[model samples]
Target chain A: MMQKSTIRVLLAGAAIATVLAGCGARDKAPAAQPQVAPSVAHSSGNAGSSAEPQAPQSKPQAPQPKTASVHTYFGDENGTGLVVKQTTITYASDSDKYGAALKALQHPGDSKAVSLFDGFTFKSVKLESGKLYLDLKLDDQARTGSEAEELTLQALQKTLFQFPEVAEIYVTVDGAKVDSLMGHMDLPYPIKRSQ
Target chain B: MKRLWVGAGLLLGMLALPQVAMAAGGATTQLFLNGKPLAAEVPPRIISGNTLVPVRIIAENLGAKVGWDDRTKQVTVTSGATKLVLTIDKPEVAVGDKTEQLEVAPTIVEGNTMLPVRFVAEKLGLKVTWDELTRSVFLYKKSSGTAAADSGANGGTSGAGGSAAAGAGAAGSTGANAGAGTAGGTAAGGASAGVAHAAEPDPDSKPGIVQAIDFTGDRLTIKTNGVTTKPNLFHLSGPERLVLDVPYAVLDEALKAKLNGTVGEIAVQHPLAQKIRFSNYSSDPPTARIIIDLKGRAELVPVEAKQLQPGQFAYDLKLAKYLVVIDAGHGGKDSGAISVTGKMEKTFNLAMATKVSELLRKEPLIEVQMTRSDDTFVELDDRVAFANTRNADLFLSIHGNKYTASSTGTETYYYRDESLDFAKTIHKHLVPATGFADRGVRQEPFRVVKGTTMPGILVEVGYLSNKNDEKKMFDEAFQNQVAASLVAGIKDYLNIQ
Candidate 1:
């Protein structure tokens, strides 16, 4: 009686082991097929247009992006200094209104400044470490002063400092430091924001 | 009584002979007196300024007859009884019963009443003689018997005798009128008559006397005895000019003393082909006739001096040469040009000009006129005008040039007109002597050039733009050279050498 019962139990154990193996194989096969097909579709599409191919290819690398930073100097209307947070400001390349006001202060009674800043527009504003950095692109109209210093100061300080994020503003004109516009004064150093 | 009558007859005969002698011998006497060679005739007689001739003689010779008048210095003459009555110094004559006024008066002298010889003689059909040299009176009466005899002798040639006699008489009258009438009339008339008439006297009068006037053409010549007197007084119109002419004149001490305050100076030159000229300058037409208070007699040869050329009637003032004015142009605010180094043109011009003036001042012959000694803008016109006002001899304007760094040289510019030669002469030496690049002389339209009456020119020194030129322009040694050259040129132009 004991020999017959032990043989039946061994058979039952063998059948259960077979069923679990089959189920595991099926799951593995479906998963492998789906992954392979999508990769193939991607490769074909890349082959059709090489220029857009890098977009998808780069997606995996998107999380590790590159950052560019530039430093500039600025002064106030009276060439004074001031401070504020970097987050509150917006910067522009050509902001003629701001430039005109600064030029007005420089010339004091010059009427030509009104027409000289007519079409100028501003481009971008940036801040790093509490200092406001203004990126400006001045049109021909905005370039005044014997050397355009007054116009640079006007646009940079007035426009950028309007934002609360801007604290101490700095400006760079065409990537250089010029002595003065039209020989009115010495613009040897960066102009400070007027308080 | 018989002896008395013989003596009276002798006396009467002497008087009658003298009259005949005067008619004949007086011809030669008048010839020498008239300042002309003997031409022909019966000389014209001037009685109380009226020319006259013997009525009976002229009329009878002219184939006319004489009639007696008992009233009013009258004598009647008739040709075929066409009678005319003439009186002394009267413009009236009676032609038969009708009275006619003559254009001029008849004249009487020394118991001889004379009438218009040509008029009365021709009217009376007589032949008259005119001695141009003697200016004496004569008549050739044509008798009927003489005419008949001449016709018989010469076969109807008697007509020739009559016409020839008339022509000869006319010729004689013309000659006579030129002499005695001319000389006697002018001498008696005096200077006042010539002035009143504004007419030229006849050319046949004595050398030292006034002559008969030619009312047709106004020309006058007066000769006076040797006596140094003031110029004869005369009046003129139209920018009224006064003229004075003297022969053998010398400025005496008294005259010189008077001239000091009254007359500016005297200039001398030959005014005419044979006349020496004297030009006098005074504030006005000499209020006091130029009283040539003389030590000796000076001859007066009054000539009507007229400019044959078109210009101011220059009175040649025979004066000693001494005075001269030198002028410099541009000053003050009119800083002509600014150098690259910021030196003002005006400053340098004035500085250099002043130096030149100082140099000239050292010379006794020169009188310098600085248009502006300081920094002040003088108008271009003012520069030359001032020189003219001062009667300057030479006007020189100093200027410096400014141009791009390329322009480098010294140039002198003059107004290309006749009046500015003195300026041009100075400029000739200016560029060469200063050791600057001689750009040569040029003609320009500048105010100083045009406005000056005197000779004027403008000098442009070395360029202020060129570094080399500027250095030379600023150098004192160069300036001295310029000044010296300018002075030398002035002296040379004036013939001071």
Candidate 2:
């Protein structure tokens, strides 16, 4: 029994080390000011899946471009530790879908739900083999610990995975693939969507 | 500004590396496999706070022949019942027919295939024993081992009453393990998940009383009503602390009253020490938990008291060497200040900071840890947290300054009054060594310095923005000179010649 407990702790430490190994800082960090809007810097050679038409509402009209709001998770103030919250994020166009999802993570629906990207910016985002890759540059204000690290990754993963097109999310801090998210949780590359 | 530095880049990995730092370190841990003491080729290092040993030593001792594949970077070990395949920097291990997700990956450190000891031991049906005081990992095969069963025995006694380690007539003291009357009165399930376990403690074991707490000389002792069982003791660095959990002891009326007047959410101080908090943290076999918030890195002395009084026994602890935290200013995403010669201030800060560590490490008495060892982004808050948790004796943040062309010299900064002496000591040697105009030492409310509890100094080696100062700061010879001078200043402050 004691050995099992000891193993759990070791696993936790290993989970954390993997994240720390992949975490990197930018050479030139900008100030802590939050970036304005998601830029058109988001690029995609293939955004073919999320282009399906929306089901007609009430009466048949021109096949309206499908739009959806992203759902994200954050630590809650009540009995349960985490609660999933929705934001006014819309993914209607294929070219701008990734940026919209990332924007939701950068600025959460609730102020209480922290923005993981508040002090960071992304150089680019890519999708291949059904996985979305994010190359981010973290700034000085970005907190590093079990809580901040895990919550930030969950917020990003849960939000981006909302799109049927994105089945897994692989995060690279400043362009390096990571083994864990923020040094504790196991970050299996192409982080799969969590229920 | 005098506080300028180049941005520290957080290095990503190849197999795309993410972050650089894993966890903190402590006194070296010794590894012992089976009944005989085993030695690791690389001496087993603490990575991210977990003690990892060379795979070959333990695998061979467990009767396994190991083979390493250079192309695949995989380690395959074949034992009697186990055939294991592990990859470097990957999180999964395949044991026989079962695939298990690994918490930590096996890595090649300095060309040695190092794997986490606990992971290896448990997978092979061996028990891993951790000795906190000596920092030892004792591995004993499960069939003949009694340690696991001994620890589990407490669970049987917890439900009936209080700590019954000795399992005698005093077992009727109202179960502290069942969320009943214990030390802090938070019920039995109040064992915090932070420093210790969250599971229920044994309630039926022979309950022992915590008669007294003794603090004298260089050691602190805990006195109990009977022979204390294997109470676990270990120290954690961040916010430096010590934890002692006596799983078979209950808070009797005498000790409960003392704890009642004390042991709250707010910690009470001991004159010689910081604070000692107590609780009846478990109920299974009944347990008593004590937490000590320390002021520095503490080393436990091997000598424990045989007897304090007629019925009381004592456990002794001691403190160790002075801890020093070194901070390299300006890292990734935050470019502190660009140099007049187009060099990044972050570059010089890291260079000099590492040099200082290289020189200081030669001294046996001083323990040095850098907030960063490479071009990685570490938050300013975390930098202080690293020092604060370690309860460092001194903190030195090294950086080259940036200012108008007219502003060209060395200066030192301090936030608290206690830090003034440190600033003056470093500046006295640094200015002359740099051959720049002396701006002297002054007080400033810098985040890194202001937040840390220990005396801290932020030294501006030279102006990165000034032409002459920039030229000097950029030179490798000058950088080494500055590093040596900083070490000298530290030695002087520590009263070393």
Candidate 3:
């Protein structure tokens, strides 16, 4: 039994040694073959260049994340409101889903006349609790209303309640609020989101 | 025979003595010339006991000397090299450079050479003074110095000499009417001839119009016709400007008075270039009123006047309002990082930034401005300079994160004390709204944030390389929530709750 166990152990050791030798050979083969096709390609493309072999392209580097907060909307017996805290949202690229959802909510008959929300696209959207948050893309064509007072409120209200996740929406155009646009309206408060 | 000769000689001597006395009386009357009497139909000439004054005497008193030629029957007066020659019994006189043909000629009265008083006085450019009490007339030469002094004293209203010319012309014609119609016709013709000569070039005209005048301070309120229009304020080097558009109307007294005290000079013009300029004289922002006369046009288009600073060779940007600077990071050559699906981190950063700007502009409490609105490379120093030039209120930079394709989160940073506090407040709500991992607020020396005087912060929304983070970033619902949270955070920090 002891002899048989020793033979089996030796066989196992031989197999391990073979695997180790294969790894070593695999590792050294690329380094030893200096006149290979890749080397020739490199030399031809970068003649007289003293650059080292390029590193692998697929390796991921650590990200420098900013410190910011998040908030969510919730409806209760007390009232419909928001709960704010520190959080972060993951990055993504598909912006059409929220646009499509917002388009579904617009009144069909009045949609043509109600140009305030036309071409409205959000860079990103998030919902905390019941409240929806949107990062809007402002442009000259985004202006609303015929008069100062009407335009300001219409712009504010139209942009706020376009999604189900949002019960209330707060807007910041370029990160600040003006006393009036064109010195005409007194926008005293943040525009609340309501259907 | 001897007795007869003696009697005749005595009679001749008596006749010669009376003639001498009459000549003396005529000369005296002309020298002491008189003006027209009050309420008199005609301007009276110098007359003594129905004996008309001699033209030679009057002319001499008015700085003109006279002489007589017996062969030609002409009398001449010479004063200061100017000679006046008149022929007796002929309606004509030659005075220095000008010649005048009189209506009534010299007549022999009591053996005296008596002529028209008005004719010679006017010809010599003398002023005749009248005494209502004595009915006496005085002739005096007009002194330019004395006339100038009188004009200055009377505030330049000494146009009496011109009126005297009219009076003389009228009297000459009236006096000739008493004689034969021939004299009347001659006087009328002479008066018309003198008028033609007097009608020369005038020396007075109006002043030029002043286009604009500016006072110190930023409050530009113009009142005109009791209605005020929105004032368009701007700054120029020569003068600063506040332009108020109104219907064409004149400035009222009160408005003029206010401008006089507030501005160095107030100019009124037709607003040809559709602009008015104001110059700052003090450190404080100037407050001024521009009265626009709207000519009853109720609808006036409002125009914003941008202030431009003078550059070395170009127009510089003038800060019309408090500036807010926004910075979008990792632009141009720096792509930052790529997501699992190959989405660039810089693109996400720019997108969020654009959204943030849109949200900020909706608020009217402050002016929303950006350092960059398009996807272009902006130098670090240039961004800082733009904010500094405008005296910005806040500088917020937007950026996105990238990690080992596994990490996912949101974070915010600030380099200064206030900015750090602001980051904490903003991150407090931003992280959870997007449902990404919270990286916690931090302090770092960011180039754009550190260089400005205003409170500034930088935001990193999520890790672009992380699959989950990328998915959330691509979600439209997430970005809107993130934008709303950021705005709320700012409002909270600004005490706008």
lDDT of 2 by residue, B178-216 (tens): 222212111011111111111122222367776665556
Per-residue lDDT of model 3, residues A59-121, tens digit only = 445322111111111111111111111111111222333333333222112211232333344
What digit string (tens of lDDT, one per residue) describes model 1 on residues B272-363? 21222122221011111221211221222333336222211122222112234433433443344456576766667777888887887777
lDDT of 3 by residue, B250-343 (tens): 2344444544333323333332222322212111011122322222111122223333211101111222333356677655644545566877
Q: Give Cα distance to truth, residue B256, candidate 1, Å.
A: 20
Q: After superposition, how far is residue A9 of candidate 1 from its true place, in Å?
A: 99
The CAPRI class of candidate 1 is incorrect
Better of 1 and 3 by lDDT: 3
User: After superposing candidate 2, which stretches have Cα over 4 Å from the reference?
Assistant: A1-195, B1-195, B198-201, B207-298, B301-319
TM-score of 1: 0.30
Q: Model 3 — TM-score against the truth?
A: 0.31
What's the distance in Å from true for residue B147, model 1?
A: 76
Per-residue error at A131 for model 3, in Å? 57
Worst ten-residue run, lDDT, model 2 chain B? B11-20
| Residue B274 accuracy (lDDT) in model 2 | 77
User: Each prediction's DockQ?
Assistant: 0.01, 0.02, 0.01
Quote the positional error of residue B364 for candidate 3 in Å. 2.4
